[model samples]
Target: MRNPSLYLLPALIALGANVAVISECQAGGGGELTAAVRHEAELNQISMLEAESLLGQPNVHFFDVNTLEIWAEGYLPGAVFFNVRDWQKLLPAKKDATLVFYCANRLCTASVLAAREVMKLGYTDVRQMPDGVYGWRISGRPVEKP
Candidate 1:
């Protein structure tokens, strides 16, 4: 049998070099709390420009779920690397803060998993950054890196 977690993640919807704002949602047994997440994304997905505008919002948090290699390449200025292995230990102390998650790009699902993880951790304000760093760069935004 296939690993069930993979099914709960969202799939990328690429249109040529662009990512569709909305993508289909997949999940375990087909409809879990994550299903609500997918639906909310349909209505509230954040754009690179919109996210840029909210950069200074004190209540917002950004989570970077991109692979270590991708992160090493660079990432959003305030992004947090709650990677699969060490996330539990680094869980944000604030459970009610607004959270945004992104992966390699619009097509990547790692962010979706991260979003779900936060929800399980009791975070009520979560938004999936459908377009990850690739979108940021394409939109002319610079990232912070070592």
Candidate 2:
């Protein structure tokens, strides 16, 4: 039989590349123009993998800017539910908090809108995770439900 582990490296690389491309495409026209579009927080725009790494660090907070039902169905591990409508109240007043936002998937606008809202609130370090929930699920990352 063929060695199963031999296929793992290529498969993982392909998956990672695909995820990155998907995220880039989802970022509005896919370039500096898209990046120029403010998404609430001015935090460094990064891919899902980078977001995951940031999440692993202490005091980094993940905010779900989707509806209650969607948040209840699934969300990134340790993500805190915050409705986009009530974002002002839910988000911290501090400008230095390491806050990240995400939505249903790569195609969802929830995360973008949430980021913009955060920026409006004067939070200096905010970013929207590119792939959102779908990316998280596809990457075999942990998610939690209400």
Candidate 3:
């Protein structure tokens, strides 16, 4: 009989290669949220430039998922404070409205979680700014102070 371990070697090698690819992608500054979040959230990821372009567009709404204290420090101009605990009441009545969610930075997953939550709540148009407000501020974009 052929050696069973011989067949296992190829599977292990493939798994290792996949892991390496995933690590490389994450290290490439593709935003901190993992593949699991992307898969589970099933929401669109927008770059800082794309988010900036959406600014001031009618029907486009931005939501800050950071804490009230953090939000008070600064936020994307025209963004609404998204209280995760009270999101049901704060969400727009139009489920199909274009909603963009963001948090502190790429490392913060709050926006991802919030986006996923709203998606589950039957919102048809949901997007996440993976780079978040930090990326916006560092990019010299305008931010509104409370």
Candidate 4:
């Protein structure tokens, strides 16, 4: 015996349309945010390991651009914590330094934004550690907490 639903190709198409519409309504906002993030990453922003490798060299300073609460939790050793929200007040003091900014993780924009601010402050050498503190910790790199 033939299944009637299998023969109803038009009915299947209609059901698929409804499913797509429902899913789109549910997922649109998240999808747009994810696309924006991916686009930003594709902009070839600096990354954590790059910052780490560069740290082994002279003149590079690692700056944790996360909030104090996040910084106090833990961070890559030797990193100086600076609040991104208050960079204008803090970054000026270190404007001449070679700065690499990092935040919560790779998905975060805080570091990138901080790097831009550093650049604006006349820091010739500035980069965003895109993979951030999470990558540093997960890679078995040295870290410290207080």
Which regions of candidate 4 fall more than 4 Å away from where they truly are?
A: 1-44, 84-89, 92-96
Q: Going through the candidates in order, what is the number of backbone clashes in each?
A: 1, 5, 0, 0
Specify the highest-TM-score model's number.
Answer: 3
lDDT of 4: 0.72
lDDT of 2 by residue, 1-146 (tens): 99998989899999999999887664444545433555333446668888878876765788987778888878988888877555577766567888999887778887787787677767777888878787788888888998
TM-score of 1: 0.66
Q: Which candidate order results from sorting by lDDT in descending order?
A: 3, 2, 1, 4
Screening candidate 4 with a backbone cut-off below 3 angstroms (N, C-alpha, C), the clashing residue pairs are: none
**What are the candidates' C-alpha RMSDs?**
16.2, 14.4, 12.2, 7.6
Write candidate 3's Cα lDDT for 1-66 as tens digits. 999999999999999999999876645355666544344546799999889899999888999999
Model 4, 9-87: lDDT tens digits are 8889999999999876745545453533432222235765666677656666778888788888788777878875565
List lDDT for all candidates, in order: 0.76, 0.78, 0.89, 0.72
TM-score versus the correct structure, for each prediction = 0.66, 0.64, 0.70, 0.59
Per-residue lDDT of candidate 1, residues 26-108 (tens digit): 44676554424343333246888778877768988888898889898888888888686768766567887778888888789
How much does candidate 3 score in TM-score?
Answer: 0.70
Best candidate, lDDT-wise? Answer: 3
Task: Flag regions of model 1 displaced more than 4 Å.
Answer: 1-44
